[model samples]
Every structure is written in structure tokens, then in C-alpha cells.
Target: MLIFGAAVARDRAWDVAVELAERVGAPVWAAPASERAPFPEDHPLYVGGLPFATGPLAERLRGHDLAVIIGAPVFRYYPYVAGPYLPDGLRLLHITDDPAEAARAPVGDSLVSSAGVAMQMLVGALRRDRREPEALTPQEHRMAPHPPTDATAADAVMSARQLFATLRSACEADTVLVEESPSNLADLHAEWPITEPDSFYTFASGGLGWNLPASVGIALAESDSGRRRAVVAIIGDGSFQYSVQSIWTAAQHGLDILFVVPRNGEYAILKAFAELEDTPGVPGLDIPGIDFVALATAYGCHGVRASTPAEVAAEVAAARDRSGPTLLEVAINAAVPSLL
Candidate 1:
């Protein structure tokens, strides 16, 4: 089976894979990239990472009777070469957090729900069936070494670990986290442990500039229920540029939302890729100094700039006290290694 999504969805997908494999007594294939660590690599049922081309992946699944995909995108990219992974009449089941993703993927059956809830339901059903145990083999336990940490403290104002811990501590149980900084999510996921279901975490459809707007949607949902759950959006500076207008909506609605901007003044992910390819720097990647706080103020939302951990903590606390929208601009060192 195949599953894909953001970090939070990836974790839910893994849970679903584990339960399904055990119930059907079949091996499970996980394709989370090396960047997403702490996954159950020790499991023997793991088939290995998914290949880049569909031909190879389909060839590997030649005799499989069913294909289950979660979280992962089906139309991520195209390479032209194609073959049916499932034989004629084989069943295909897909689960995804995004309804759009579920609707877009080629599938016979699909479930549209948060990945966490869908996984819990699937596992609960399997447990009711009292399936036999199908554990991983010893050989499959061997996995690639962990990715090296190449980020320097000077590159980022605060490490992803530090930022998550601070936020986790400052927020209440009902808080919702909307994440669009895809490049930093690996580190964020590894550092944060999600134990509650209400703490909704969302990622874009492998697309940029959805973070701020998505957070607004989540906040509006919470407001409709008359719940006091705080909505927090951790967005990259580059991503925030895409839907900056959302701030005005949040202010107009008086939504209790906080926008955390991890500013590095450049598309750090693209720069890293370019460096790896030994290519000259690309144009329009660098974002010169922009006062995000001022932009937020222009939208009638409270704003603050944080350059240190203490300042971040203080600003977060202040935003939490406010009853309306606020923006916290964090000047992170752009030199940090890409968690991808």
C-alpha cells in the first residue's frame, strides 16, 4: 500500500499501514523520505521506500491483491511511463486528510477524514476482527542511517526542536496547529508528539502558500463551535507571502489566531537544492528584509517581531492573552539545514 501527506498525516498513515498489514497478514510498504525519521523502520513488514517511477513500484506490487494508500499524493508528478500496479479486479482503498486529494487520486474506494481519526477507525475495526499477528522480519529492520544535521545555530534563530517545545508548552489542549512550512516539518514532527485528536495539524497539497489561509479556515471552524481553542499557524516567510490577505479576514472576523513567521529572507529549501546541484543561485528566491509585523498591523491585527527564544516566548504569551488576531515575526537564520 502507498500513503503520502505532510508529517502529521504521514504518522497517521503509518499507523493505518501497521494495522492493515497485521490484519491481512501482508507486508507493508512505507515511502516516507529519509528526512522523516523516527518512523518504525525497525518493522520487518516494511517493504522499503517507494521508487521514483511508477513502473518500478507497480512491478514490485505485481501480485498484490489490494492496494491501500494513505496521506501520500497519487498525482504528485508525472514521468509518462505507466503500468497498472494492481491486477485486473484488484481492490484499491485510499485514505487522506484532504478531501481534494481523495477525490483526485485514482481509486475504487476512498475515505475522507482527518488521517488521525481514519487511522483510529481502521485499526479499531481490524482489532474487532481479531486478526492474526504479522510482524516485521529481522532483515527488513535494517534502514538507512539518519540524515546528518548540517544546520548551524547561526543559520536559524531557533532550532525546530526548540520552537515546537516552546509552543507546545505555551498552548492549551484545545489549540490547533496549521503547518505550511513543509521544508521544516521533518524536524517539527520529530520534535513534537501529538497525543490529542483536537489538535488538528494540516499541510498543503504539496503546494505552497496555503498555510495562512488554511489556518483562517480552521479558526473559523472553531469559532462556529464557540470553542476557545487557539489557532496557530507556523508559516515560512516565503509561504506567508502567498496569502497575506488572510490576515485581514482574521482581523475582520475577530478570530483568535496567531501567525508565526519563520523568516530567513530566502527560499532556503530551493537554495539547498541548488547548492546540491552545483548550480548558480536562482533569481527571485531571496526576500529582502520585510517587516511582517507592520504588514499585520496594516491589517488591523496585533504584531510583534522576535529574534530570540525569550522574545518568541514573550510574544506568544502576549498573543495568547489577546482576544483577536496577532502575528509574530520570527527572524530565523536561513542557513539551517533543510529537514527534507
Candidate 2:
């Protein structure tokens, strides 16, 4: 099985990955840190992102005897929890550019090289030996277009699930997402499966407010290339406030970026963490009276407010088609989500 990671996605090595997978009949897996899926999730031999914890990951990889890691670390974990690193009896072979990652991994034999080049050589050797890998039966894609009814509007306001489904339906196929709203990622993963390379991005550093600035930089680069791909930065109000100044830079450059701010009036992710840790809800988590629309207009970018589904779709189209930057402040339910 192949584990595709951020380096692979950033390096644009999906073509070689597909060739290697096809030749070896190997199942491909994506990591959560991966910007977008290198291998199409619809492929029969393609697996979803790995589980969050060590125990859960071992269970998920139980059936696979061999794990070939490509362009990613052996594992990137969080939560500071301790457990078994890998399943017993499973051998790992890594091919990556970073020797540090290979050396630090608990268990793995690594080949230091360009992942694309290594895969090409491996495919050539396999062909020379006339080795025929197992062919998997293709299966129909299982993702549903919309989430459950209860998952949509919470407290009669647009929910996280609703926002993602609406964006998925409204945006162009090549549109890419730069995500920072951690509380809503579960909804994105559920409704919006990564079908294309470089279509989705998120910071795995667990740091807040970084993606907003990064999104602006990505917009500038994409605009410079003259690609028609829409760049949407779907961020939380808390995250947006941290780097609100970036909007000025985006507007100054006339970047064609669509900033979608889900206004829940508080740090919902932190609330979830408080519940998980059995600690009291911290003060100063609630944010109010921040006029994002006014801020956007002052910065010379267009802004809109959308509370209904139809209104949101219209705003999405406007943001995507506009020549300059635009911000859509969507009022959403202030419901606390489960800790990731």
C-alpha cells in the first residue's frame, strides 16, 4: 500500500503515483496533512486518510502486510497521547526527499531520492520482470451530495455541513479550498471528498490564523499564473480576526480570492477542547461586534452577507466571478462540534 503525503501533493507527483499504483496493484492512502488527495479517492485501490490516533491507525492498517511511504513522513501525529507506533509484523519502505524524517521514524527502511524518480525506476523494474500485480474491481463512488437533514441548519442558522455542501455544489470543479476552520473539517471530509490534486489545503501545525495569510499568498500566485481556478479561504471568524490585515494586501494586489468567513461569534473549536479536557469554558472566547463587511469595504474589497442557501449560492458566484478580492461573511450556528 502507498501512503501519499504533503510533499507528494506539493511536488505534484500524482501522475507518477498513479502509475506506480496501477503497476503494483497497490492500495493508496492519503494523510490528513496532504493538501489534497494525490490518488483519486474514487479508484478501487485508493484508501481514505489515515486515522487520527496510533491505535486506530494500527487497526486500519491491519490487513496490509507492507506499507510504502512516499513523499511523506512515516507518521505525523498530535494530541501528545502515547501508544504503539505501528502494527507488529508490518514492514515499511519509505521513499522521500527528507532524510531526517526517514531517520526519525520508529521503524522503516528508507530510500532517499525524488519520489517521482524512484517510482519510475520501480515501475520499470517491475515491468522488466513481467510481474502482474493484482487488479482491483472498480467500485462506484460512495459519497453523498448532501449531509443529513439534521446536519444542515442548526438553530435555524446555516450549519458547517450546509456551508461545505453548498460550496461544493456552487464552485467550479477546479476551485481549491484553503481551510482554517478546524471545527468544521469533519463536515468537509464527509461531504467534499478530494477528487483532484491541489484542490484542498489545510495547515497541520494546529496553529490558528496562519491559513488566512497563506490563502492570500496562494491567491497571488494563482492569479499571476492566470489560472481560472477559484481560490476560496473558508475560515472561522476567530481565525480570520487573527490575520485580518492580510485582506488589505489581497485587495491591494487585486487578487481574485473569495474569503468565506463562518461567523459563529466565538471560538467553537476551543469550546470543544474545554469539554474534552473537562475544564471550564475559558473567557474571551466569545467575539462580537466585528463588522467584517465594513472591514472588507474599507480595505477596497467587495463584501456580502448571506444567511440563506440561495443567497449563499448567489454570493459564491459573485465572489468567484469578481475581478478583485471578495469576502462573504456567512452567519452560522454557534454549535460546538466534537473534538477532532
Among all candidates shown, the one with the greatest TM-score: 2
Give all candidates' CA lDDT scores: 0.63, 0.75
- Model 2 agreement with the true structure over 1-340: per-residue lDDT tens digits: 7787777676787777777887777767775445445676676677567645566667657877898888877776644345677778788888888989878877779888887778778877776433355665422221211122244575659887788789889988888888888767667666666778877777764678789999988887787888757898998998888888999999999988999998889887788678757776688889988889998999898989998878889998887668899999998877776543
Off by over 4 Å in 1: 1-67, 70-75, 78-149, 201-203, 273-278, 336-340
Best by lDDT: 2
Indicate the residue-level lDDT of 137 in model 1.
47
TM-scores, each model vs. reference: 0.67, 0.87
- Residue 6 shift from truth in candidate 1, angstroms: 9.3
lDDT (0-100) at residue 131 of candidate 1?
A: 45
How far does residue 330 in candidate 2 sit from its true spot (Å)? 0.8
How does residue 130 of candidate 1 score in lDDT? 41
lDDT of 1 by residue, 34-91 (tens): 2232134445455443433455546655665777665554534322236664456567
Model 2 poorest ten-residue lDDT run: 139-148
